[model samples]
Target: MSTDEEKSSGSGRLLTGVAWAILLTGLWLWGRGAADGAGGASAPTTGDVAAVGRPLGVPLPPAREPLAPVGPSRVEIPSIGVSAPVVARGLDAAGAVEPPPFATPDTVGWFGTGTRPGAAGAALLVGHVDTSTEPAVFYGLSAARPGETVRVTRTDGTVAVFTIEDVRVVGRDRFDARKVYGVHRPGRAELRLITCGGTYDGKTGSYTANVVVSAYLTDARGV
Candidate 1:
């Protein structure tokens, strides 16, 4: 691996809804609450927001056949200047997918119990938007656009090259885990990078929405 580096809450209503929507997936129980500013220290919130739906007249590459499941060891998004190590993480006591500890804000966290990157499913990775004092690894994630490339190096020594297809800042009022985290293409290998977004609310001490960057495997190569 290599270079780079970046939650929220609201009322309890947001937590319950996020938790429930994720449960419906049944593949991985990554309740948004895990990214909901758990263990937060109040850095400036992530304000970059947009949802560039697939553009017309731009043909993305076909999905490559999924490789044998293997854990990711590192990730890179050159467009956004992201290059960082990826560590396995599990569900927290709250049952939501946990992010890396606050002390290591530059590292990315993978859902250890879920689909591995380059496998035939959506592999989930998360990172902090900010800490008590500064921006974290995924601080610029929402700035990524479709057609951009995200490379994930796996334990098997393969680099999964995923082409970004969608970038959405899902608001609390419109959060949907199945739509946000579920596999977009059933047979394709997918990857999702998530973090807190929207305006930070002092009332709840969390962001008002989440930024989700969705992509699929278009190519793969040796490390």
Candidate 2:
């Protein structure tokens, strides 16, 4: 429900296979050759690139009982020293979740129409890794380690505390919408923090992959 400063910025059965092929083809076109051109100033290392697609190793905790849904107002990651205001955002014309604008690069955007932070589903929060000129709110998001905590304060005066379970980079080519954005476990409240990652192509002006941090609600307060 908050406003930002002025700035600039499915399916089943055998028929699903055809849809997937088309989608994958589109991703390849949009992100092709992203891995090329090495030795650039900011090119990610081979280790960094390889780590993005690795399976999660963090142990999952016992699923917590569900809580009432609450609109998130802020997010904090103590280990990473991130504390930022949160604004609700909707899908863009491309049907992808839109992020906060460059003008307010420090703010985090929550997918308002989806699951709320403390509810029994995966609540998504996204931000920019960097703007055209400099690093943004989630610039250091990839450095966050599993087992760290992400706290979300809600408009209803509640705080949803989640524990990091996994952190992985998903290349546009290998992106799986259901896995990346779907609920990992039923009856549990989860949170996903995402931002662009992988190689940045100056020619195309876009990142070739996305960084995703997965967590689940472990505690709550002020309910």
Candidate 3:
């Protein structure tokens, strides 16, 4: 197969792996919740969001013109005390976006193939919510309120300032790729910070939902 075909195949597999992971996580959460007699209620099935909680719809800030592209070196969220080095990552063997290693859970992973930070597209950054023992860099990401600032330090010694527009904890089953991963405005530079959240299932070793913080570039300094 050609290189492009290989990438496509890998991406397809990655999506499959993500879906299976979500399903297995839900099942495990349900079984464990039932076994623990936590309210003596059966665990909700996959896509059964009655117990997963409602989706949040935080208002976005006004769109602005895009800035020149620049590679990111670090990400900071002063509101939640997050400061981490940013590393570029591609799909894993399973085709899902490879997150920072568990050993270095404090680091953040950027989808290097897509739009660079401060550019006219959605730049994706993902990190672990927590390791087995402690909270990761993005653990408090969901608590970020609208209008907060997310600063991305670029390799060019400039900081791209993004203002938070929305924060939502979306269940894995109901995840909408287009809405969560797509660019809202054609010429606006946006950033997405993602981490796992919601109920944790020991059996599945995964969280029931993903916390996505959406922001857009409002200003830049040292440019």
Task: Identify the candidate with maximal lDDT.
Answer: 1
> Tens digits of per-residue lDDT for model 2 on 48-139?
23343224675655656767877999999999889999998764444444556657989998877667888876777877776545678888
Model 1 lDDT per residue over 67-116, tens place? 88888999999999999999997655555555577688899988787778
Assess every candidate by TM-score.
0.77, 0.73, 0.73
| TM-score (C-alpha, index-matched) for candidate 1 | 0.77
lDDT of each: 0.69, 0.65, 0.65
Following a full C-alpha superposition, what root-mean-square deviation does model 2 have from the true structure? 12.4
Question: What value of lDDT does candidate 3 attain over all alpha carbons?
Answer: 0.65
**Model 2, total clashes:** 0
- Candidate order by TM-score, decreasing, is 1, 2, 3
Top-scoring candidate (TM-score): 1
In TM-score terms, candidate 2 sits at 0.73
Candidate 3 lDDT for residue 19: 30
